[model samples]
Target chain A: MIEARHLSKLYSRGVYALRDLNLTIAKGEFLFLTGPSGAGKSTLLRLLLREELPSEGEVTVAGRNLSVLSSQEVQAYRRSLGFVFQDFRLIPRMSVFQNVAFVMRVLGVPVPVQQRRTFQMLKWVGLQHRMNALPDELSGGEQQRIAIARALVNEPQLVLADEPTGNLDPDLSLEIMNLLREINARGTTVVVATHDRELIRRVGRRAVTLDHGRITEVG
Target chain B: MAALRYAVEEAVASLWRGRRSAVLSIGTIAVALFVLGAFLVLTVNLERLAADWSQAAELSVFLADEVGADQQRAIEEALATGPVVASRAFVSQSDALARFKQMFSDLAASADALDANPLPASYEVRLQPGVTGEAVEELASRLRQVPGVADVRYDRQWLDRLLAAVALIRRIGFALGALLTVAAGLTVGNVVRLALHARRDEIVIMQLVGAPTAYVRGPFIVEGVLQGGLGALVALLALGVAFWATQAPYLVPLAAALNMTAVAFLPFITAIYLMLGGMLVGCLGGILATRSESR
Candidate 1:
């Protein structure tokens, strides 16, 4: 569950990154945030993640107020959600297994459980064969899959993917999007930010469009 | 336990990944600690030598020739009951003359040319342990007041000068050691900062994945402690080598005089304190480096 009431972010005097934006999404819903560059989609996700606070109003995720959580509490809150970045953000020196298992490691899951779940998640994302391969050695598609596996390994209730397919070929982008769809079908809420209308059309999820720091449409 | 192991593994991994920086930091710490350790060794031995000199201080109460056996006995009784006197021995005129001749064997013929026994009888006075400078002076004044005692003398000025020099050396050594410790800490901080810069991407990713600040900072702290510890070890090794190299016939007598074992392993207490100090410096450096925004 999530709620944002009149959330606005001001980067500087006379410049607004997000202007009094308000939105809501139910549990287990998959949504797309679409807009041109500088449309506040990333800002909204960052606010949800509590990486930065809104200049005005509040955002809540999983019943916890983002504005009021202490830094330590914010970190704990983040652990309950998953994030997939456009760049995959894998530690290049680490193997695929390490990349995916990192989330579990942070959460202090027992070694045996981490191994089992990481292997299972990698298999689900069709990356089990590349477990020992470094991020640099993997294809763009494989790397994204590894990122997806990492995000899902902790079984977070909500997953936020910031332009998850921004660096991939069309075919690879579609594959990554389909994997996200599969994750949503398995009951994880997913919100993706991207301007790729073709991919948006292909997936046909509920879409929220923003422009000039305000949400312009929703379908 | 599992989390701690993971943290330690991460720390070791970071050190390995940034081996060049680690080496540089460790070397810097070693050099700083080496200077500190050398100063400490010198100060410790010097203090010991000063203490030995202070403990050996004695007062000589010379007696007049007109003092007969009865007056000498009276003075010996006064000395025996003196609170400051730990021990005392009477040196008769004959004994004193023999000692003077032995001390100046080249002047034996000159001494024999004297018509009468010129040496005066005296009482050699050893004071109680931990007697102060004022106490020594008071005892000397007391001895001068004794019946038939002509002169009471001790090397008070020389002892005072020796103590003052020791105190000055200690103060300077403390200041220099503190300055080098700070330098070592900053060097470690710079190294940690470089390691953080090299792994910035990983740090960002770690944050995004919900790793706590402690989790992210833990490895750097461990790295700092390891660097400091290794540096201290190197310094100890160097000190041991230097001590060994110089502990032969050159310092054996000095060591024996000071009642210290020749080239014995660094006193356990001193070694422990030095290691603890090194670890603290490293910890400070780690904390300084982690104060910046890692994400």
Candidate 2:
């Protein structure tokens, strides 16, 4: 459901984040982007999310060109995908329920439907008991679970997680990884970027490795 | 409907979350609107006073003592046909003396000391509506040329000064009101900007989640409107209290002299205009705050 052709992102002073990278991921595929710091893994994911423009390439996701979409069209296009930040990025002042329900609210869903789906998603993520709890009150693993529920509440076709387990312990990381796997198994395309090779080895997923702005390995 | 509810809920929540800043914004708006309201009240009353003075204006053409009845009749006939005269009344010496006595009731002994009637028989000429300045002067000049007329007099200098004062007040009031309006709008804009800065992370998350621009902007705009509206309400209350405290001893007599109703001097329309002005200022502020996409 994603395609990139000769994608190259350049920073100031002649530094390249991604250099002439061509990549594709089929629908409902679970893909891991493994790389060290400054290896362009995050840059590639940002390109897919259309959060940044490439210096010398084009990206198409689900048949829509990211570079050409108008601002309004970009927003509408982004609604079809979900993003999970490494820090979990939950609104600090809101409850877990509010954080998850926020996506549906943005979609203009009715309050009753929002309540129902938010509760159901929280239950699926084992956060139903802590729905009314604030983000600061939750453990790192629990917060990540809330973030996952938020990403999945809208039932988006694709999910992009950038270092989703970066702040958690080894056990919590595995738990979050397994949750992402289950989400992928449910017919959602999942792309995760992480430098954690042991976690990648444990999950046994198809992996693409980037080094020095180039794809070094794929398996 | 669902979107509107959410927007309102978010707006209210935002206000509650940032109550300190909200209070500061509201206070600033209130002070600005209070200045505007004071200017409006003063201008309206000044205008009423000017109109009252203008309506009472009349030209008095004094007849010469040696002129005969025939000459006097001819002058009165000319006055009746004059274009500027809306109406004219012939006041004889006795009638003029009676009016003077009534005006200075405490001077009865002084008035009785006079051997003969000192007042002149005159034509009290009421000009048509809107006759003023050079128009009145021209009409007075024409009256002086008529037979049996000794002098033509009207309180033109005082009227000119009053009208000039009114015009000056209106001009200054307009300028100050405009300045305060702009300041109020900018204050609201600054407040919204600060609120946006406070919620920067939340905004980023919202953008990442594909929240439309309108969805993010709606609540801020609504918050601005609430601030402006509450500020205007406070200003109106301040104005009302000011008017009440000063009315009986000050504005009542002043308004009475101007032939106006003291309580109605500030019309209902002024209040409506003030509220709408506040709302418009808020909307402008909201637009300015959200104009940039840098965030």
Candidate 3:
């Protein structure tokens, strides 16, 4: 579950990355957050992730107070969410297995469990064959798959993606979205932010649209 | 403990994953630590040597050849009553001759070549505890003015000069230690920074996922400690080699000159402290550099 109430984020030089936004994502729901460039989609997700706190608001995600949790507690809260990035922020020097196993490693899962879980997740993402391959050795789509495997390794309650298919072709984008949908079907809440109208129309999930720092539409 | 172990594994694996970067960083740490260790070895030994010289020191004053057995007894009586003299030993001409011959075997034949009693009789005087440098000098002068005395040689001057040099070296060693410590810290910290930079996107993602700052920072600290530990190991190995490599060139003859009962390498205490200090520099550097970089 995620909720933001009348949140406003302002920066120096009168920049409001987001303004007066109110939204709630229910448990186990799959939704797309949509907007054009500079439309505050990333800012809203950042607030939800507690990476950047709202200048004035209350945000609650996964039953934790995002606005009031200490930095440490915020990090704990982050561990509950699986996150995908537009650029597939995998450590290039690390093996595909190492990249995916990172979250569990930090959580200090036992080696057998880590190997089992990472191996299984890579298989689910259709990347088991590239487990030993480095991120650079994989294609853009495969790299994104590794990132997705990393996100899901901990079995987080919610998954957030800021443009999950930004770098993929239409076919690859559809494939990645289907993977996300499959994850959603398994009872993990999914929220993706994207500017791709064609992809959004193709999937036809609940969509929240933003315009000039405010939530303008939700369907 | 499991958390720390995981942190270490993550750190080491992450660092080793970037092989060239890890080697370069660790090499920088090792080089700095080696220099520090070498200086530490010299400083510790110099301290011990100074103490050895002080403990063994005494002033030997030779008596004139014409002085009778009675005057010699009188001078002994005078030195016996002096408060500044803690202890005294009278070496007769025969005893002095025997000791001189024994000390320098190459010069033994040269001693027998002399027709007269070339090695004179002498009194070896040890000064009382708390006798100042000035006290030793003035006492030696007083002894030289005695009726049976020919010339007095305290060798306190030599002691004073050696102590001064030791003090200077100790000062220089401390300064060098500070400089080297800073250099080591910076080198390790910068290495951590480089590792973090190379993994910048990974860090960003970690932060994004609600990974706690500590979790995000844990691996880097682990890497730092590993670098420091390896540096210490390298330094210790180098010290072992240095000890053996110089055994024939420096230790054997020096040990012979001192008439040491047993020769030894660098003290174990010095080695332990060197390794600990080097490792500390590394761990501290990692924490500091990552803190700044992550922020």
DockQ (C-alpha based) per candidate is: 0.74, 0.78, 0.53
TM-score of chain A of 3: 0.98
Q: List lDDT for all candidates, in order.
A: 0.85, 0.86, 0.82
lDDT tens per residue, model 1, B1-295: 6556776788888888888878888887888878778777776777666666667778788999889888888788767845577898889899998999999999989989999999898889887656677878877787678778899888766778877887888788778878888888999998988878888888887787778776788878877888888888888888888888877866787788766555244577888888888888888898889886452
Judged by DockQ cut-offs, the docking class of candidate 1 is medium
Error (Å) of candidate 2 at residue B189 is 1.5
Off by over 4 Å in 3: A137-140, A169-172, B10-31, B40-52, B60-86, B91-122, B126-153, B212-215, B239-243, B249-264
Candidate 1: the clashing residue pairs are none
| Weakest 10 consecutive residues of candidate 1 chain A by summed lDDT | A70-79
List, residue by residue over A126-171, the lDDT tens digit for candidate 3. 9899899988988999998888989898998999899989999999
For model 2, how does the per-residue alpha-carbon lDDT over A41-125 read when each residue is reduced to its tens digit?
9999898888998999898999998999998888988898888989999999999999999989987998899999999999998
State the lDDT of candidate 3 residue by residue for B37-98, as single tens digits. Answer: 66666666666665666666687889998898788877887677455787899898999999
Ten-residue segment with the worst summed lDDT in candidate 2 chain B? B257-266
Instruction: Please identify model 1 stretches exceeding 4 Å from their true place.
Output: B68-70, B81-83, B253-265, B293-295
Candidate number with the higher DockQ (1 or 2) = 2
